[model samples]
Target chain A: DAGITQSPRHKVTETGTPVTLRCHQTENHRYMYWYRQDPGHGLRLIHYSYGVKDTDKGEVSDGYSVSRSKTEDFLLTLESATSSQTSVYFCATYRDPANTGELFFGEGSRLTVL
Target chain B: GESVGLHLPTLSVQEGDNSIINCAYSNSASDYFIWYKQESGKGPQFIIDIRSNMDKRQGQRVTVLLNKTVKHLSLQIAATQPGDSAVYFCAEIPSSGNTGKLIFGQGTTLQVKP
Candidate 1:
């Protein structure tokens, strides 16, 4: 297991409310990513960071924002959550994105928007 | 539009039997592929990975095969056990050297019947 931890492992919130999930890693890796897992849709990337203050959008970045102010922490924010945004969120880190190394994943955060 | 997909959504196998999960990708430029297993209420765990330069790679009781000719990837588990029952996903990274963005395929749920 990797030294990754996700905060608020489970949460249920109302629609249109703001939600934020936090990912913390002690591995000192250079790459971090946010992904959402949904039934039949597999896992979709939301955002990723290569270093502190460096972030990029992914295939499913709509309606979601991420910030990486420090190398150890990455935050995913959903402004005005919707029912369609409910899914299990996973955080992962890698030493080198271009290398063949496997991404180490955290436990995951389960969010529900009703 | 390049995408990764699975041939079957569910696979059932008896304990001690062999199990195979198949994936296909449309991106011919994808050079790296990985197999991950996710149990209920947890994030995906890395199983094995193979690069386009190789035809097959094995790890423990798992094996990953990559066929660039057919744009197909497969994971084989020998002597499947109850602990091997999980949703397996195949992910690919393009060869264009992007920021490690991985495209994941629709998962195949492996059920091991004891």
Candidate 2:
């Protein structure tokens, strides 16, 4: 199963509200990534972590932040949710960086901001 | 923005037929490319990957073709099935770094009709 799960499969929220999406993996992968998929933008990376407590911003990291305090848990937080931020968020993990074998992904979390 | 595909190109194919989805990348230094499939309300799942050193790679029912000369990549699905209806994305990894930062292209939506 690769063992990756995202909490709150579907959520409807209000604008300016704070939301957090959690990604947990039983594999204890070293790399974790957060991405948002929109209608035409494909999937844009928000943030990623290479190791515990080490993270970096992705191309579309303006309104989003991420924290990875453990090997199996990565959290994506929205300081203030907006309508434009409504999209399907996905979390992925990898065992190795050099190996392009595969990135195990979660089922995805769908968020709609009203 | 190094490379962006705002308008995702689409391909419609009949069931039992073959399907091909193409992508063009910007970074010539990218050494690894991957193909992912994302069904409705789900995260992108790994399909296949090809390295810049190799031109083609095959999976059980899928093949990935990489043209380093034109910086183009294509994914071919043999015997398109109804379950293959999904959005497909192509991602590239920089050659120099081992960072888990992957540059993704706008995904192509494949519609398989019976």
Candidate 3:
């Protein structure tokens, strides 16, 4: 039931440290995205990639960066983790032109910065 | 100013009842809309979707109603169950073909009580 898998399902790290979350997909989708969910706020897009090595910033990409070196893998990195950055992260993939961009999401990665 | 938003923050319904969730989008250029369900500690799952050309779409136990006239979208669930309790979100994709980006609504937390 898991076409996509997020590594380190749950992680806790100290503030100011660097953290990276990985999203891997078995489906060979063309578009991949990373989003973070927090209370009272909608899922904010962090970054997305249209193809290999093609990445773009989203609405809330100030402190985060992303890379899609391959078609099956997308990585999100926090340069300096902050407590305010703690939230549940999700990875999603979509087949655009065909399904009209119906996004299929992975389970999730819960990160806690202290 | 094409933002997707929900009308309510929370909705509580009795078991075996029908539940309705409403959303409003600001961009008429958006051609695709989708609904997602998220549990407490998990990622969001695709529920249903509707295209701009169509007004209604139905799935097994869920239906999506799109009103392009008013830029409103709604999700209807038949016989709401406890298992259906989760946060629901509505997302819209602009017709600009930026398949990598989706504007997500705030969210509505559904509570089904027996």
Candidate 4:
């Protein structure tokens, strides 16, 4: 079973357009994290959620925003797409609130800003 | 500027031969570390993990070794195969303590020659 799933597996958008990627989980994990993967940068965290309605910034959260309305869903939004934001986005979840070491990740969402 | 880093960007090994990928971390207080493998067009998958208290851990045909003195980590794959060709990354918890965050390293690509 897929514990976590990301929507819009592949998306191509233009600059200045708004885009939203959805992450849904069936495991009911209390913590959710959004990350972007680039060629040489490996994976950089964008934002993370500790609980419903609670979110925090990460290493590269300057151009991204995230919202967790429910325990099983976390949404990432790009106000305006930029060429620098073209990347493969991944969503991860963990069951323990204190243990963020072991994370279960989703397949990923590839976003291309053209 | 303290982050996890890898020794090489790519490594080519013949099939049925042994392969080793190395990493170094700046955080001396980081007690928990994890290794992840990512194939092309896919999100990273967790391979194994090690703690500072322990020097080594084994999983199937893979082994992870932690050298706290040198702040180094290595992953060894026995009898490498084509399926093992992927990018490997090392991640560690912040030295400030476990605040539910992980710092990922620049990935090292392992190519298994047929």
TM-score, per-candidate, Cα-based: 0.96, 0.93, 0.95, 0.95
Measured by lDDT, the strongest candidate is 1
Superposed model 4: Cα runs more than 4 Å off: A97-100, B95-100
lDDT of 2 by residue, A1-114 (tens): 679999989899999999999999999789999988887677788999999999998888999999988899999999999999999999988887446747888999999999
Q: What local lDDT does model 3 show for residue B67?
A: 90
User: For model 4, what is the error of residue B48's alpha carbon versus the real structure, in angstroms, after optimal superposition?
Assistant: 0.5
- Encode model 2's per-residue lDDT on B38-66: one tens digit a residue: 88777788898887889999999999998
Which whole-number lDDT from 0 to 100 does residue A85 have in model 3? 93
Instruction: Rank the candidate models, highest lDDT first.
Output: 1, 3, 4, 2
TM-score, chain B, predicted structure 3: 0.97
- Docking class for candidate 2: medium
Question: lDDT (0-100) at residue B64 of candidate 4?
Answer: 94
lDDT of 1 at B34: 90
Each candidate's iRMS in angstroms?
A: 1.3, 1.5, 1.5, 1.7
Least accurate stretch of 10 residues (summed lDDT) in model 4 chain A?
A: A94-103
Ranking by DockQ: 1, 3, 2, 4
Candidate 3 segments exceeding 4 Å error: B98-100
- State how far residue B56 of model 4 sits from its true place (Å): 0.7
Tens-digit lDDT track for model 3 on B49-78? Answer: 888899999998899999988989999999
Cα lDDT tens digits, model 1, A1-114, are 769999999999999999999999998989999999988899999999999999999989999999999999999999999999999999999876345737889999999999
- Measured against the true chain A, the candidates' chain A TM-scores are 0.96, 0.96, 0.95, 0.95
Off by over 4 Å in 2: B4-8
Each candidate: how many clashes?
0, 0, 0, 0
